[model samples]
Target: MSDLPIVGAALSLAQFIEMRDVMFGHDRDLELQDFHNPQTLDSDYTALVEQSKKALDGYGGRHGIHGPFWDLPLATWDPMIREVIHDRMFKALGVCEALGSTHMVVHSPYLEWDHRNIMHYPNAREGIFERFQTTMAPVVKRAEEVGTTLVLENIGDIDPHFRVELAASLGSSALQISVDTGHAHYAHGACGAPPVDYFIKAASDALQHVHLQDADGYADRHWALGEGTIRWQAVFRAIGQLTSNPRLIIEVYGDQSVERSMAFLQNTGLAQ
Candidate 1:
């Protein structure tokens, strides 16, 4: 396995340059996105990609794109959303080519924000599954065209088992899984389920990507290493047994927490 499967975290190109100059010293490797602007994504992205390319050359680390989340989860069931999401992803892929990122991380969308909409889709549960089959098909097409692998992450209520099975069933080898340990942990807590069982049950064959992080005992606090009650020994044992070492994206949401978390990962030596 690629030792630790590319130790990294989420970043935007602007942030990449800052991290490059100050953090990496050589001023290099990282991939990030700008989620705030709806109008300037194109020009903004173009500049970011150029800066990221320069940074990667200096940093001596690999770059990988984590597409934006918090608002535009890709699984949103709107047809118009397809264009907006695609545009964002197109810019991201442009970064991929410039920096030679290993792959792109895409979060699965959440259930409808409106309670009424959820009850109205009739087969929305089924439609939700099919929605990916339709909308995601283009995402896959785009990834191939852009020469990057697209990894779909498991989010709230979107069953992890279902995510892996769907990827396998679709039979698109390029499309793979980004197993979010935190999401799985939270999903289990929300559903009154077991965390270990949830992960162990995932098809090992379908796992190609993964996100590893520890959370505070009762909440998804995104704690630094050894502080969370995630049963790291057990988690590492389970992950180590797998045939392939999936990309381990250590995501610490904002600038404030990234350093401590990165230290924790190194100290824990789970991915090492």
Candidate 2:
């Protein structure tokens, strides 16, 4: 038991625990701001800070932060594109520092992703990799300033290996990897796309967190672990083989659904 790692939920301040005593067991919707838009800045970030402060000071367990993942382009590879994502990182850092979250999960800015096929469409993917490097530089710096770690996640079309290299080259401890299992499943000849292991084997060192969910080997949708046609054991074993236990975040959204999911994780011995 001493070797067991803590399992936790990906939450938003809006669903602070006081609202429901049974969140783990029932269907409850959570309101995590769409990160890509970067516009959902917490107007009352100060107040939100006070609240999460009270939450941890008053309540305890494993608590982590999930940054905006949907709207912002963390992998855009553009120099001036900060106009699209800066505020989101600023606000996300607010919650991380406020709650003392273990880590903040963000996405790798991607381009020409369009549904799925990026690498296969050689013409479309050409040169976008350069832009990816262009965009990450500033965001990497911002993450450093906050004294927080940003777990950059894998998405549909970007090469996870290249993203890992970018984070590594930064040489900042604040930069880390966030492997989204479903995204990998989709990218690996699943997700209605062709065969490609977007996350290369050499990229494992950069990982600091994970998104635990699965899908039929043909789509990128986040499905509940066992419900999906994924080989739960293979995924779990692959992750556990990492040098250390990762901060796992459940990305399959559903209010009450989390309860059953949590139970399933335990039963599958994922907590071990």
Candidate 3:
């Protein structure tokens, strides 16, 4: 086993509320996500927030939160959309504070379509970079105030360097990188990008959290670790060199897969 602390599992806010007994019965780390509805700065989720805290009562483990990212682009060509993203993220920080979450994962603003256009024009990257910075600065400041770190995760960037630049340029202790194994693997095979280890090595210093899921060379299956083609040994080796280990969470689909995911990792010597 890798001997890394198993940060537990992930669940949508809906799942936690609807399936509390089955989902939160175990004493493991939790990464909660509010992905079901459109949340705004002024919207109230007090009931769900109360239920979330109650579900974890008497449990002892780490906690992290996933901010709303579906159709919410952090870096955008539209200034109005950027404002909306900022509002939603600030609100997400409120949820984090209520739950005592230490880290919140936000989707990176790198899209393959944008990258292609930037490749053709060679100058459009600056605008995208600026938009990302404009979106993240206030969020980072809010995170610092609330004692939560904002972890920017890669989505569709053909190159991982964009994430490095985003985190480095901001230059805040509240901002860090979150490399999703499935997304990086898909980017590698689908975009002819560098291997997954490249991302782990490049983001090692700023890396703080991970979504440990497996996928084929095709889509982001989010399957059990050994059920797909990721090179677990190489991934751990690269991560092993990091000065600080990240919070490892097994993000899989289906309820049965949870046990199977942890079993595969333990069997393959990736987790204990």
lDDT of each: 0.61, 0.59, 0.78
The TM-scores of all predictions, comma-separated, are: 0.77, 0.75, 0.89
> Candidate 2 on 99-210: residue-level lDDT in tens?
5655677776553254356546665444454554455566667767766677777776445565676567667788888777777777665434322223524356567777
User: What is the C-alpha lDDT profile of model 1 across 119-138, one tens digit per residue?
Assistant: 67677656666766766777
In model 1, which runs have C-alpha deviations exceeding 4 angstroms? Answer: 1-6, 12-43, 58-60, 73-76, 110-125, 200-203, 217-219, 253-259, 262-269
Please identify model 3 stretches exceeding 4 Å from their true place. 1-4, 13-27, 39-43
The collision pairs in model 1 are: 11-32, 12-32, 20-27, 28-55
lDDT of 3 by residue, 1-272 (tens): 33554546777756555645544454566688652246434566888788778876765667878887878887777879878887788888888888888889888888888767886875688877787888888889999999998888888867888887878788898889988998999998888767788888889789988888888857888998788899988888888888766777778897667678877767766665
Query: Is candidate 1 or 2 superior in TM-score?
Result: 1
Choose the strongest candidate by lDDT.
3
Clashes of 2: 23
Better of 2 and 3 by TM-score: 3
**TM-score of model 2 relative to the true fold?**
0.75
